[model samples]
Target chain A: MLETLPLSLDAVRDVAKECFDDGWRLVTMSANQIDDAHFDVIYHYDKDLTMKHYRLTVPKETVVPSISPVYFAALLVENEIRDQFGICFSDIVLDFGGALYLEEEVRAMPFCKVSVAQKQS
Target chain B: MARTILPFGPQHPVLPEPLHLKLTIENETVVEALPTLGYVHRGLEKLCEIRDFNQMIQIVERVCGICSCLHALCYCEGVEQIMGVEVPRRAKYLRTIWGELHRMHSHLLWLGLFADAFGFESLFMQFWRIRERIMDIMEATCGNRVVVSVNVIGGVRRDLSPEQCQWIEEQLAISEKELKQLSDTILSDYTVKKRTVGVGVLTKEQAYQLGAAGPTLRGSGWAQDVRQTGYAAFGELGFEPIVEYGCDSYARSAVRFRETLQSIDLVRLAIARMPAGETAADVAGAMEDDTPKPVSAGERRDIMQAYNRDKRHRFVTAPPPNLDLPAGHVAAKVKGKPDGEAVTRVEQPRGELLYYIKGNGSKNMERVRIRTPTFANIPPLLAMLPGCELADVPVIVLSIDPCISCTER
Candidate 1:
């Protein structure tokens, strides 16, 4: 099991800055739907093959601060989460605007377990 | 000069897969590059919800053809770790052998494609020709060339015999000799160096900052290879991550070139030290029809012709006649459904392939997030592309060994 430090939506950037200052390479972020109303966005970091994880349990309606400003590598993965989970992120460096993998006409989160109607609400 | 947006690929002649980049160019030099993905996004991560955990092995293998064995190995290792299953010693060595063979072939294929990208047709053919020997070894040993589905939940489904090991060593000897013959052309030739040496340079800082993996990172003087993490038999095999300090396309190609020979040596080491034991745990069955049918003269000629005509010809050899376990026995015996999470990382030919698996104590897994090496290398590719010439774009892109199928998956 992955042992992750829990973070609120507001603490994502501060924790990411700490990781950057400590010479951690941003490996990748994995986002999975915890429930109909919450998504667990896990930020994985690595330095010298040792990994440290920070997970933010984000509510569906909340807009999480993007960590791409601290680590430029986080932009692509953050955009990917937005495309797959219907979660919004603010101030991504290269914001694909949720079009990284989804077409504008396709108004569905293909990765979500809940119904599209329920997610939009 | 007015800036122009030159769209490169989605269907460019140089790209082996569809990856479009909108390059902002001013007077033949790229000022900026913005990539556009999603031409082939299949949403394979979503399949974990529908397919059972056992069935997802085959699906994950399809994520990338060149490094398919590593994909299966990574997924199986994750599932096994989650279930707390200890894979057998021999099975670990077997996985290492097959995984390195996949790396060898994948590197050779990329070298051939990189040659083709720069218009070196004969050099391209030469690399592919050498790669065919590895393919033949795979076909004879594991029944398929590209997607050799030998990995199971707890261990491997296939075991190498003494005779097969000897034959593989002989084949590797020939490939190594031929590869050394072409090293001058690949590494020091005037034309090859003219195009590759200083093109698309990425410093160690840029590579690490932008999250490069495998040869891309190593090419930039960072010896970061997940294989050093000691997955499978790598810890026992005396492995070292190959590093080249050129920080250019040449360095990346050189890293892969040197790694091909290293993989051959690693396979030899694994075969010599492989312990004799059951290939898989909890496997119980008898030998059933483990014979190879004799091919007639006409069929042999036709097979040879098709194989020579096109490398992608599906060489329809008989399936490997190993492991005669009952259909449902292997799955049923591995204990209950997985209830924990596992973060598995394997060094693929392209780079580090990561899998984040979470199970909900059900048949289907809750989440299987694959962070492919190509996916991590894209940001580095973007960093390298901005200062290169339009003519050098293909070389710079292929230097990263982009696998669009794996990236999109």
Candidate 2:
């Protein structure tokens, strides 16, 4: 009984702004790497204990726009997705430069099954 | 006037966990605070790829020491939902009892730590002294003090006898009376109030906008708790979320203190109303014939391998003959691999703990994403840090009840 609204990468910012203006709280975001080339990212929002999810499929090379300006709480989870999936986010309020949890030398996403060398090449 | 940067923690007198925060201060007032984590990151989520869905229940229990039972409950609930398994009513009530016991102990531990954060030595000892009673209750019921691995996908592994239930009530009565004795000091003492009453104020608007959960949200006058969703036996228990409008550290402390008393009442109610029946649903076909039968060669091999893998039971050399597999052996086997996905939320002592589980009709899960309560509360903690004095940093940090281990996991 999980419901989600399909969203394009371009519509993420607009939906976030709409949710913020209409009194919705940003709950959290979760990302799943579907394959080596694609990832599915979900944004969860809440109002009065009711939750809504907006999901978009992104290519690994795509840079999703940051919603941190609309919801400041999105910064941390966004950085976490960046570190874990290697999905770049643009215009984050506080960018950890992909070192939020990993060291600088740890260049690969630990969550992804592909080897670091395979991912880079 | 130039701002000076001070690095706090990774190791500090006030914090037992390693949470490093860089505080930029002008004179005595903090202008900005930046948190750096990863000190205790164990990459536990990745283990799901190797561990089967059944063993992940024990894995999630290690997420947090204080709320281990609730974590296991949440994971089991998620998997059950995915597989369309209905937990029995008696099992639901049992989960309620153990979950509340964990809440009581976690709050007591936090209260002791909160007291110690402000240099109240004797009060710290007093709170933990009462906490031991609840730990004893858990040990007596579930056989382990902290990580009571009693929750299975279909139901609970352990059941309580009537005598044991009566004994738990007696122990809880003693703990409740002792806790009431410290109420006046914790609520109205001049020093306790001065340090916490107005120290870290988070207004209702700011709290909601920043995604605060549990007591942090309730402490700011929001009647929002995941328990209200009635995942377990709470639906029948007439549960109501506790709210305090003080919007400060003291408000958060009062919320937790009052909740400890609420948990005691809840445990007693769950036991009294528990129905008499089978405690768990027979997910596997093993429950059809309960007679003590000789172990089959294939099943015996599986048991030996299981015993070898389990570190706690590894001392045993071989499987015993005519293994009397008890009733409610729900953990022994599951019908088939779970397919599809489920998102389950449980009300942990800290706040709402969420699990996103996906199974592709395989032993290994496609993904298992955990969103701990501490992760959501960090932004609100950051909002409260600025405009506070340097000496009050620990008071504000402790207010959120940050579990760095849970967060970094």
Candidate 1 chain B — worst ten consecutive residues by lDDT sum?
A: B283-292
lDDT of 2: 0.88
DockQ of the candidate models in sequence: 0.78, 0.73
lDDT of model 1, residue A84:
90
DockQ winner among the candidates?
Answer: 1
Worst 10 residues of 1 chain A by lDDT: A112-121
Error of 1 at B47 (Å): 1.1
**Local distance difference test scores for all models:** 0.88, 0.88
